[model samples]
Each structure stands twice: as structure tokens, then as C-alpha cells.
Target: KKKVMADTNVFLDRLLNYDKENMKESTVEKMQPYIKDKNFRPEQVKQVSSALVGLCQWVIAIEKFYRVNKVVKPKKETLGIADAEFNAAMADLNVKKAELKAVDDRLALLQQTLDESNTKKQNLEDEFSNTEKKLTRATKLMAGLGGEKSRYTMQSESLGEVYSRILGDVVLSAGMIAYLGPFTSNYRQELTEGWQSLCKKDNIPGSERYVMANFMGDPVK
Candidate 1:
């Protein structure tokens, strides 16, 4: 109410001091009586009341315009602050998203490495298993062949003994073949016995109990 009264007084002072030269002539003439007198006569009481009502309406309209502007001005500033805060929040959110993506990428790399390591471990295990199986089979095969070793060893030793006597056997065989083919059985036997006796006397190898029939492979004897 006080503010309304102040605005009313200011409006009245402006009306009293209004420049008549700038105003229209008809408008100045119509307002000149009220502006000069500042007091309403009994006959002009209704007009004065009407003018006061118009002045109050104008004051109210002006006050409302100023009040609306006051409210809008601060709201505009608040809106600017709010827009800046929103932009900053969005920037923070984008940074967080980038960080999350980096973390996800790192996690994927680690998972891939772990998978590769697992594959290598599996391959090593398979190789070890296969090698172990081969070793087991080889051990079994060697064990199975163990029984023949002694017989082979004895055969080797017998062959070595036969090899040592080969020279003496060859000499006796050659002589018998050259001399015995043309003789009668009794003569051949007699000659072979004499040759055997001579060989034993000289301590020749394989001559101690030599048999002509056996050496010659003669089935008739």
C-alpha cells in the first residue's frame, strides 16, 4: 500500500510538470484545467474521481511490469547458473564413462591372457600325459623282452667258442675231403684214425675224439 501511494504521488508530479509543447494541443487543453488548479470543484468531482481511478490503474500496471521484470531478471541469472552446473555435470559423467570403458578394456585383456594361459596349461598337461603313456608302453615292452636276454647271451658265447676253433676245424676238413673220397670205407676209416692219432699227438684242437663219418655227414656210416 505504501509503495502504491508513493507511485501515485510520483505519477501526479509528472502529470503537473508534463511538457505542453510536446503534447497534442487538444490533450493539453483537456488536462490544462486540472493541472493548473490541482483542486476539483463540486461540478468536476466525478471527473476527478475518474482521473484518480485511471491514475491508480496506471500505477498498478507499471508496478506489475517492474515486479515481473524483477522476478524475471533473477530467474534468468539462476537459469544461467543452472545451465553451467548442468554442463559441468555432463562433463563429469563423460569422464566417468571413459574411465569405465578403460576399465572394461583392461578387464577384457586380462581375461584373454588368462584364457591363453589356460590353453597353454592344457596343452602342457596333454603332452605330459602322452609322454607318460609312451614311457609306460616302452617299459612294458622292455620287460616283455627281458626273458630272451639270457638265451641270446648263451648263444653269443657258444658262437664265440665256435669261432675260436674255426681254423683247426677248417684244416682237418680240408685234409679229409682231399684224401677220403676215393678210398674204401675200411681204408678211409684206418687212414682217418691214423690222422686223428697224429693230430692228437701234436695237441691239435678238435682232434681228441674226431669221427670221420660224422665230420663227413655220411649217413651210411
Candidate 2:
């Protein structure tokens, strides 16, 4: 309101100055030509001049007010709009930063999980390698054991064959002794010599030596 009043004062001052500068020459000189023919009355000319001055003053007041105040308002409104846009842009940036942080966190978790999986895979591979090595050694040991078993089996069979031959020889010799001893006492020396020779040829221990050591001093029964 104070500024409006100040502009009104300035407008009134301009109007008065304009009227003063033209008071001598413009108003009267312009009216003189028409006044000579009495086409305009004195009272009517005064009213017209007053109306024109008032109209010009009013127009100047309005135009000055518009020029002065025009500089003050739109800049504030544009600044407000700019501030709003800046705040919105900042908010969007903050949201994007939060989203990026979340993505980084998720990526970190995934990397950790992948590292754990790789460690587990490496452990499993090592275990499998160790198992394979153990299995190979076990297979080799089994093969060696099978060879030993086969050799032992062959030795056992050879022993069995030798035992069977020795048993047969003993039975035959015992039968010969039983049949010859009672009826051929005079031929005993000759028969013992022949038995010794047979034992030597067969690569067997002498049964005659055992018999003489144990049974010669005892009854047959």
C-alpha cells in the first residue's frame, strides 16, 4: 500500500510537471485556432483539458506500478519452482543410492556363497582323490594276497600228494612184514637188507630203525 501511494505521488508530480512545461504554449496555442471561430466554449475547453490530464495521469500511475512490481514477483515464483524440482531430483538420487547399496549387499552375499561352494567343491575333490588312491592301494594289496593264496594252495596240494604216496608205501611195507616175518625167520636178515635198499631208493626214512629201537625189545602185541 505504501508503494502504491508512492507511485501515485510520482504520477501526480509528473502530471503537474507536464502541465507546467506546456502551460504557456501547448494548451492555449492548441485552443486558440479553434477559439477564434468560437467553435469551443471556455468552460467546455477547461473541462476537456482537465479530463485529458487526469486520464494521462491515471495511465502513467498504472504503467509505473506494473513496471516496478513486475521485477519482484515472478523471480520468487520461478525460484520456488526451481527449489521444488531440485528437491525432487535430490530425492530420486537418494533412492537410487539406496538401491545401489542394496544391490551391492546382494552381490556380496552371492560372492560369499560362491566362495563357500568353491571351497566345498575343492574339499570334495580332495576327498575323492584320497579315496581313489586308497582304493588303488587296496586293489594292489588284494592282488598280492591272491598271489600268495594261490602259491600256498599249490604248496598244500604238493604236500597232500607226498603224504598220499608215503602212506601207500607204509601200508605196502607193513603188509610185506606181516606176511614174511613168521614163516621166514631164516630170511629176516636178507629181507631187512632189501627193505633198507628200497627205503634209500624211495628217499624215505628207515622203518627198520624205528622198529628195532622200539618193538625189538617188546612183544608184538
Cα-based TM-score, every candidate: 0.53, 0.41
lDDT of 2 by residue, 91-130 (tens): 9999999999999999999999999999999999999999
What candidate 2 gets wrong by more than 4 Å, as runs, is: 1-73, 156-221
| Weakest ten-residue segment in model 2 by summed lDDT | 208-217
lDDT of 2 at 4: 42
Against the true structure, whose lDDT is highest? 1
Q: Model 2 compared with the native: what TM-score?
A: 0.41
Instruction: Give per-residue CA lDDT, model 1, range 1-221, as digits (tens).
Output: 56745787786787557453344446545654654553533335546686565654443444445547566868878999999999999999999999999999999999999999999999999999999999999999888778678778898997787666555566677877897788897987787677666666777656345664555566975
Q: Can you give the lDDT of residue 186 in candidate 2?
A: 56
